[model samples]
Target chain A: MTVQISDTARPAAAGTSSGRSLRNLTYRPEAGALIGTLGVFVFFAIFGGTHFLASAGTAAWLNVAAELGIIALPVGLLMIAGELDLSVGSVLAASSMTMAIVSGYWGAPMILGIVLALGVGVTAGALNGLIVTRTNVPSFVVTLATLFGMAGLTLGLSRVITGTTSVALNPDPGSKAVFGTLIAGQFEVAILWWIVVALGVGWMLQMTKYGNWILAVGGDKESARAAGIPTNRLKIALYTGSGFGAALVGVIQTILYNGAQVANGQSFVFNSIIAVVVGGVLLTGGYGSVVGIVFGTLTFAIVNQGIYYTGWNSDWASFILGVLILAAVLMNNTFRRLALSHAPRSGKKA
Target chain B: MTQPLLRLTDVGKSFVGTNALEDISLEVHAGQVLCLLGDNGAGKSTLIKILSGFHAPTSGTIEVDGQPVVFKSPRDVSAYGIATVHQFGGTFQLMSVGRSFFVGVEPTKGWGPFKRFDKGLAGEIAVREMQSLGITRVTDGKRLVGSLSGGERQALAIARAVYFGANILILDEPTAALGVKEATHVLRIIMQARAKGVAVIFVTHNVLHAMMVGDHFAVLIHGRKADDFHKGERTREQITDLMAGGEAMADLEAELAALEASAGSTGRS
Candidate 1:
């Protein structure tokens, strides 16, 4: 064994140490997302001028980012685990309505409304997990079913209970301070929540056994099961996490806007996915980083909000976004290829 | 002679009405290589699944070290120290070597919420283990599993199983997809594991490869054990013929000869 090591491993180690470090940075999973984020930020900073670069302008995009980031982080985890939760949009709407109707329409304690709202999200996620695991159906189809079904359920329930499609909420002081308040008269309190979520998730994915299981499950479910990972349980937990994230976002929206709308969260479904994909997470699963998702969210928000600051037509924002997504994906694919093709040269020399 | 490390008695598995496996018994001893040889649809996968606890036996009992145990899931089988390395090494392609090496059981440092996967320790141990198995090219455990060659990936899987203290290692078609040199490397690794007293169940249809490392051999034909013997008891021809379901190979030769003879006669006429 010692002979083999000296013969095969030494040359490769010696050859690559000098230049590989720089190349390694480019090959990292988050490299594309980081570059994309910076590219978009610069683009907006140029066109939107001093206003886009200033404090209030930063707050505008930061607020949008914080809300989308919270949802995108868990959604990113689900994608890494090789599943999709399309119903996050509906879960957000449902939870927002649940909290609004309970606290606003029924005049119940704020705490109860908050609990029930989050509960609705967790339950919906668990249900998605159960249906996917128990049946051989793909999670895409299962979650898609929940997306429409939950939307109808939330809309129907809201109309029945409040007798209106929209309901108003006047949050209690404590809840307002925690969930709804704007910091410095500009930045949304949700930004703090986004930071906490990012740190927690980044640690879990990079440091925990659960993170390893999620990657394994995403890479190959059958192989993961053979390795003794509880694939079903892990997947269910991921779905649940995404549900909770959406619900939290819903509650935040309800508190911030002082009202709930059945149609409020539909944009989040694709938007969160867009952020995650732009962040360099593989849409097919089994590969991504939390850092990438964060960068992706920031990039998306900058482009989304920065367009309004520019004198150009707002309609072209989506066209720019469409191009950016393609470019980021192409860049990610190239890095992925580089990563896969990496091999120690000693084997070839031998 | 002594108690087999693992023993199966009258194990049978049926899906609906069709029996994928029948009442077949087998024993595997520590420090020995048991080669399960079969052709397509010969119930090799079914038996492997049953042993790995992916499926429960419809009938029969399994004994590990002379004690009866029921395997309801892969986790249960693993608790008995049986590690299965599926074809393609079963390593997550997108994960780093150290991470994939410790999947489902990461080594942690610190305590409680502050505790985290010990990346440095994990990488060191993974590289050390793979090198010990003669996979010297994998000096850096931070490399992606997808980047490794087929043989190196197999080494990684075997190294992981060994590092985790698995007493019985089941390799499902480990060499089927490998080149000649890579297959030799895997066969050598199998011997090294056996030298460490790990019982190995090497499953494959390649008679030559099986004959290289197998101490004990079992040929399965249509869900039944056609023959079971120690090495040298049967030649390559006999093993090959048996794997083809006893008379199938012989019948094929006869049919080919008759067809040639008839063609000659018709041309003359």
Candidate 2:
């Protein structure tokens, strides 16, 4: 009897080992994101005409994607760890205003202004982490509170310090070259920064011990705690990383534009989330990938910019985005179900 | 007559005004399967909690290899090579098998500034451990743990504990939800662990499963040790009656007999 049972199990295990990579693709976490990216690129490449295929047209979407990708990557990480940071928008605005007021209005050194701006983001993020971990409050609520609170602080402080909501900046040549200058006078240098952030974050999530802890925490917090993982600390660090990412984007925009406004970053609040979800991340947490988030950012950017090249009606951009979100989520749901139900095919029922 | 792997003497725990457990004493040596039997609300979970280091005893002492030690946390207990596997294997369902196996203590390779988790090593080890536990269907450690059957998950948890050098294994109703075949597989794995010299604490409400592998048995009833004996000292019916709470079994039998007699006469009429 035991021999029969063992014999029956062997073929199934061996079956999955051979020629299964193609079948396995349907179960991969980034499968939906990959498909969505390709589908949208094809959609835009055809309807967007010759100009959309040009280098400048490509840079248009890439620039938007680069900025949003930086914020989306960490936000994706936060989401995978089972938390949400609704305050990235506020962090961005606050950081932008801080840099402008410090260097543009107060005439401080450019480096000092940059450091202080990033510091504001880290502080806001750490505060979000501390409040969410130390108390029973959900991260969504805590970050929402931070979002409004930081927005008020930035707006009020900008008005008080510069006597206006907007501040103009004349960045030092060095700072401009690293953070603001365009490549070949076409693409923002932020693209390079975005690539670096993605590589680092990807390494952290895929090849590090902490990545395992993050997934375990998101999968089941109680079990992760029982396994002796420092759940709270991991969550705090993820939130802080996201804070830094948002602030980096703020600094990039402030330098690139040569000015900052109190209301410059509010669009990022929903845009970053849209990019993350459209990339195939689970909104509730525990199943996502850096590759998927990147693809998601690109998909959002292509749709956002490609519509402008179509020259139909810019008003249709939001409509397409709304349909895209529903489609991506539904696609992700189908793949996740495939993943969960993919048990080995033994003779007996599992 | 070597020292028992784990010994509990006069261990008691209190919560507010109620004693969850009282003066519970038990001992098990390496290579032994000690089955803890009890009814619902019989302090079985409390005892398991105290043993697993989730709760500090309010009184008495727990000794390991003859040295009394206090376990203020699960980490402290794990350091003593005491591991617990709850129902459904206490596993992360969404994580891959290799990843779940090494959640807290991941294996790494390469030099500093380039250190990375050794995915191949982790997967190989996880797969080898599961195969050793007779889980032949799970050949790929990259498979998500959620994809494993209930029996396979339990085997994975046991394999993990053994791989991590657990001297004593505390399983909380490991076979409660398993079918006959799967339950038998888990029982076989438990025996395999016993053969390898790891002390096993098998907690269950099922009397038959307790008899199959249990070398020694202890029954808890209402925060107290009601019985303790070696194998063959009791019959299956006697064990079941005790687990159902002593006199309730006889009362239930008599009530059933009376109801049958009345129904038979009414049906004939």
Candidate 3:
């Protein structure tokens, strides 16, 4: 006789009913970022010229932070999804080129150029996602390949069409204020864009179904899939978000300086990942906060620009940054372990 | 009656030209617990892979409710109200309890871009589902799965399946490495599932447990069916003998007699 199976399709029995609260935070990375931001501010204000504490100085560093923060947020989300995007730099270059070709060369409407730039970024991200998912390759290898390929393509294509490495952008007065204007009408409008992006993406990550899925996939992909999560889709979306962020930064660069260059937006790759980690996200995934990443961005920017204020050898800036990444990461790891160790029990509702 | 909820007719699987399961047939009915017994590598894994839709049998027909059907992917098996709760009870360790419970199928609020996780509703559902399984009390309802015990983890997984509307539950050695206390907790949950009128397929090597709780016991020998018995049809000794090799015992008797004769004549001893 054949084996007969019954339709035992019952709802998954209720899950862990333990009511545990969030674990203790003896040393919060959040606090560290706050303290670090202020510490650097104080160091620069007291040691450097009186101009260091001026609004313009604050504006300059904040602007720098705003640009980097926008990219870091999406990169942080991607890291949370257990993936990486080395192609972000290339995406920036490609998006800027798309905008330059459309608006500056072809004389297309600024809106179309903007949409096309975003579209190019999305397409690049989708391609990266597809290659990674279909080939079952590590995202590092996949995105790195895209990184070089996109960079080469951007340089080759731009040189072919423009006969130069840079594109000059001159937006209308209305577009100029929106696409290029900064705070107090002098800082890069990109700074405001970074804020808007930070808020929007922050909300998406902290308050949406997508955020939960991202965390699940990052924490444990197999479990996520068993739980019915579309993990691959979540990863793809994260990469896309990163590409979008990078692309937006490209547009801002174009508007802020009224020019686009292939060499621009290069430091963002490592710097954003650094911001994510410094912000309290573990490179291994499944942890971190948008607020933390924002603080990380500020910490990074202040240290970067603050050194200039202190009149320290600007070349030593690189050395100082290397130390900060190490120091911040170590501190964050220690605090993380403490929090997790003290974290509420498994049976307790959180 | 209605071609049991799931039917496996002469299912076989092979790996790299080696047979894993051969001529295996099994069936489970609603409100029934089928205990699958086998030695390690008795083709239990092969049979499970086929049943769980992780792999297809080289030759077999899987009939659902009297109708032959094919599952192209795990998603296909899920559509037939079948779910496999692996031994480890795969749950996101990094996510909150409420998040893990309603992971891929979270309750949503608002519409469009305004759409968001209904954390409150998800919490309510998680609590309701847990309580239904007799876990009745959870204070914060926000703990991570990593914080739960091994037994509690299993309970949560079962609850997730039951709450998600799975009718057929295939548990793979649910209490394999568990302590006595933890094993009992799992057994209690199994009984809870049966009480819910759900068909449970309990795969384990624990004979005492099989004899104690299994409504039907089916012995699998080397990926082939050796015998099928109702709960009271066979004693534990008989089941153990059959599992360890009834044929080998007969061969051993002849060999022992021959050896005894040789020893006496040779006088070496």
Q: Which candidate number maximizes TM-score?
A: 2
> What does candidate 3's lDDT look like per residue over B57-99, in tens digits?
8887888777898877777787788878778777776566688
Per residue, candidate 1 scores C-alpha lDDT tens digits across B1-269 of 79999998989999997998887889999999999999989999999999888889999999999999999888888888988998899999999899889887888999999898887888889999998898888877788999988998999999999899899999999999999998999999999899999999999999999999999999888888879999999999889878886577788999989898998978863
| Candidate 2 local Cα displacement, residue B3, angstroms | 1.6
* Each prediction's number of clashing residue pairs: 0, 0, 53
lDDT of 1 by residue, A162-208 (tens): 88999999998899999999988988899889888887898888777
Alpha-carbon error at B50 in model 1, in Å? 1.8
Error of 1 at A32 (Å): 1.1
- Model 1: which docking level applies? acceptable
Q: Model 2 chain B, TM?
A: 0.96
Q: For model 3, how does the per-residue alpha-carbon lDDT over A107-215 read when each residue is reduced to its tens digit?
A: 8888888889989888888888888878889999999999889999999999899888888877667767776786565467766677677667766776788878888
Model 2's DockQ score? 0.41
In order of TM-score, best first, we have 2, 1, 3
Q: Each candidate's interface RMSD, rounded to one decimal?
A: 2.2, 2.8, 4.2
lDDT of 1 at A192: 85
Weakest ten-residue segment in model 1 chain A by summed lDDT: A8-17
lDDT of model 3, residue A97: 84
Return the clash pairs for model 2, or none: none
What does DockQ come to for candidate 1?
0.47
